[model samples]
Target: MPTSSVVVVSKCSVYPDLKSTVKSLKLSVSDLPMLSCQYIQKGVLLPHPPLSSADLLSLLKLSLSKTLSHFPALAGRLHTDSAGHVHILCNDAGVDFFHAKAPHLSTEALLPPPDRDIPPPFRRFFQFDNTLSFAGHVKPLMAVQVTELGDGVFVGCTVNHAVVDGTSFWNFFNTYAEVAKGVKKISRSPNFCRDTVFNSPAVLVLPEGGPSATFSGDEPLRERILHFSREAIMKLKARANNPTRNPDFCAPEILGKQSNDSWGLNCKINGKITEENGLRKDPTAVISSFQSLSAQLWRSVTRARNLNAGKTTTFRMAVNCRHRLDPRLEPLYFGNAIQSIPTIATAGDLLSKDLSWSADLLHRNVVAHDDATVRRGVKDWESNPRLFPLGNFDGAMITMGSSPRFPMYDNDFGWGRPLAVRSGRANKFDGKISAFPGPEGNGSVDLEVVLAPETMAELENDLEIMQYVS
Candidate 1:
């Protein structure tokens, strides 16, 4: 077992000029219920040539102050309006910062093959106090924990998802890194206009009447880290694109020449795909490494849960809407810009089919988010705001977070790039999954999955799933 002691607890506030005059900013519909309960947890390990605790503490505090100056919303607190809508009070209330020491843990122990129980060392680094709630009057929207270990330093951050999505989350860290490296100017600045999506001052209401159920607590969930190397991802991609691999598989429609009618179907400019025509193109031709692995994991998780073949299973994927919306959002828009796109299929159809079928379904559902669909989704939420369903470990549903595209490992705070990056144990909810870029810097993916113990045992031994992994 590994133990840690808190060395310091301080409040980090935004710089003066970044403060907002508007007392409160109403959260967009997408920022309502789900964001309120979710916290983005990240752990980065820096090894060797260690700085003294004092030096690290001073360095981080200074850099954070500079970073927060630009991202003023993070320094604010979450508050609720009379009508039950969640909003950010930009009163310059500080973020919770803690510096701790872990005497017995090593960076090596945190590596992959996460089949064992959740490690105590990593858990201690990313601890979240379930007792804290955003609905409270004075809750910090961001909390930082710096755990000094034997071989490396682990920096863990828990940012309120109600304020920012994965993109904005990383944007904060990357900017902090730049400031730490003595960069005079930041490449991107945040757009704090919450009304970009909702032009009016409409208070968003959740159908559930309140925030979503917090997944925090002592739930009987197991956390496992699975890494799919670059070669492994390529193999999975080839398998998904090959129709002969599965007897019932059909070649997904490929996006060839696009006619005006197909303008939004296959049109992609600068990595932004237009979905105006709906997702009618062949999915196999356009399947990405993320989509391929996601499909495999979805199937394996479903089978491991052993749901009834006749039952309907749902897969909720977090789609970054920065480039998917009309006119596209600013690159540095520092708020929740993710849409939880859900796909429903009968267990019989999903299980009876091949990897290609599952991949196609996943790909199509993702590409279906066009300019019109995104606006329509916002309007729908305005009329009937509801939390994204949090499915159970009984295997009928799954939710995904984070992304390989976010350049998480690149955050080098003057020391060096992280040896490994991880999510906190708080993400260990049954049927939850997180994807990160593999450590090799190649285009590989590291998938962290949380499942019930029995289901995980079954998934570990799954031959088909194991084939694409090491």
Candidate 2:
């Protein structure tokens, strides 16, 4: 779609709280050179009456300048290195920052179909037209794309893993929202003071030495994160509470059955094959039998646990806490901060155990990841000099990432928000699931799954019986 002309509203002022927060950030990390991975990008929808090209440019500059004025910390990236010279690569001439392409205004595709059985993580590259990419790993990493939709637009933005966690990302976004609205007061301020939590050299030791020691032998012997349809979750709920059956069935009860069925001999991994009964016997029979028994035991515990009573089905939301480190660094501070949390189940848990059991289990696991115990472990390791080691888990697996759809869709650059947004380059992982805004503010989530054709086909074949968990 050609860039349409829409008169966009401008947020002419930056909030005071945001202004001070940015100022403090700049002061705390003043000595360090700006890392290349910390840039931020945004999009916003403009109703009818878009601005002309010239007017749009002017508005973008005006908004950006004002934002920086209040959030001077952003200017750190534009700063020089220890040699008193800014990195040449930070200049526009060095980075490939450009507007990306968007699907033209097409009524047919406006409401994309809901994806079923999105494989694990990286396979999601198949669902869209473009993806974010990079040439070399750099600090304060950045990627941007702006595409014109027929009546709308789509914007894509990405920051490197080295710098900033999700909280920082949203912190920046909320700042933009307040500034764009010309609000004087910001609801929250970003906390990046690393010293409050860590001495510099101590903070520096985490990325270098901690992970390997802590995570050794800590990897799950078998682990998989799965998804179910909203409908499937409901079905399970009914089965657990069937008055005609056992009113005693609870979340753990339902989950015991579901987990066994889901993970038992039937689950295919490591190229292992199963017989018609979802088992493999003979010499391998002993091993397969153990697997079956383990599944049964775990399920039994789930049923006995009654974990579903008041729980809400939720997405396993993972947030990296590396940034929460003491002696707060700039948004550009690099390294991992991925701390996982569950979105929290909003729907009833005990009642929907059958339908939502899987979702519930996943949600529970995710929430458990946030225990102060887990974080303390992370902090303890950070204090050491070894690089944080990834548990036995491979970074390249079929997994889902937090969706960018909600965050990147409406970035305004003096123009209007884009019509839609999506991700770029499929990552190193496999089955990738992403979430975007549902159609017409219906409050439903539109999920995009990218998976191997075989995995997708298997899921499609079972769609009728699929239940969405959290």
Candidate 3:
């Protein structure tokens, strides 16, 4: 079979020329941690529209300019002051936009079935590799690539991670989509006030050369998409909260497939299982839908890797601190306002526990992050600034970065709603998994799993794990 090919047609800088007096936006405490992290490289795939390729491209570019008028910081570049503080110089620096073509690629090829690997041709729509976030000092803070495929189109955006997180990134994307459809008023504009995140001014000192992006961009891995239906999630949630003797639950740990102990003993006490006794239930720890799924994935991946029983396994997830704080933040707060929370357990213990045990473990940790926790975290970072440790260096860590709650399918750029969402090859490691909401908005989820070929093979063959995967 002939592989798909992408030919870059043109690259240009797009300026908003807002003619405003806003000069700069300082990097917040939430943003500084991402200096070493790779850019956010994600976009959507759409069906072929009625407009000719030329007209569609022109409309996209023009609307991008109009959209940037609301997000001036995106058209700016990063800067470092004498005291080592970083800022986004809102100088209308312009965004890097690219035009590309993949004449032989089709939607079917770009989106293979869940069992197959995602083709590399889809990644060609992205311009950045594992470029560090600090590179925004010289490069465009945001880069957009529009590729023309055989039957449809792909619009991929690469935004500096230090500037916008998943929430702010999608805000801009949805805004751009509305602008493309001729919406004059932006429904949600980014709020640039720093006080929303901190009571006092926040300054971040850079490491001597800043954080290093250690990815080689050539790791041999399988990019597998795991789709779980809404019904599957509801079933998982019910299994975790309520008592059940069903043998169909996913998660090797919960099924007692990885251990010698009986699953019933680990899950139940004295022939009765309730929220009280099933999970050593923390009265305040209410297991969430996503936490159950994450716990299951953690267990599945651990079993797939076939790690030693004594090995330590850790799971980290990005938590949105917007509504968790006391006063709460502005809904449209720009820049980063998220934090990573980690939960650790021994492989032996995690696998020995029941489904609700791990699910409640995640829940307790998430619920413990309150007002004081956020304040204390900021204080600690102020004393010692560091870049986000994104990669899974030891192969025993699972990092879930994105959320399945983001309104991704709602973006319609005049043509139609997106058929699917895809990401680039930036900051992807062996155990890194990005979760996206299903394109149908039906409470389903799609997890883009990146792992070694051997582990992926093991995970694929793990029959119990494959039960929940559609």
Best-fitting candidate, scored by lDDT: 3
User: Candidates 1 and 2: which is better by lDDT?
Assistant: 1
- Quote each prediction's TM-score: 0.85, 0.50, 0.90
Candidate 3 off by > 4 Å: 1-4, 198-209, 214-218, 243-285
> How does residue 175 of candidate 1 score in lDDT?
85
Candidate 1 clash figure, as a count: 2
Candidate 2 deviant stretches above 4 angstroms: 1-49, 69-97, 100-111, 115-140, 177-188, 195-337, 340-360, 383-398, 403-419, 426-428, 436-443, 464-470
* Cα error of candidate 1 at position 339, Å: 1.0
Backbone clash numbers for all candidates listed: 2, 91, 0
- Computed on alpha carbons, the lDDT of every model, listed in order, comes to 0.70, 0.34, 0.81
> Which candidate leads in TM-score?
3
lDDT of 3 by residue, 295-414 (tens): 888888998999899999999999888878888888788889998899998888888887788887888898899988988888888777667777777778999988887778768998
- Model 1 misplaced regions, further than 4 Å: 3-24, 82-85, 112-118, 131-133, 198-200, 205-217, 245-285
Q: What TM-score does structure 3 among the candidates reach? A: 0.90
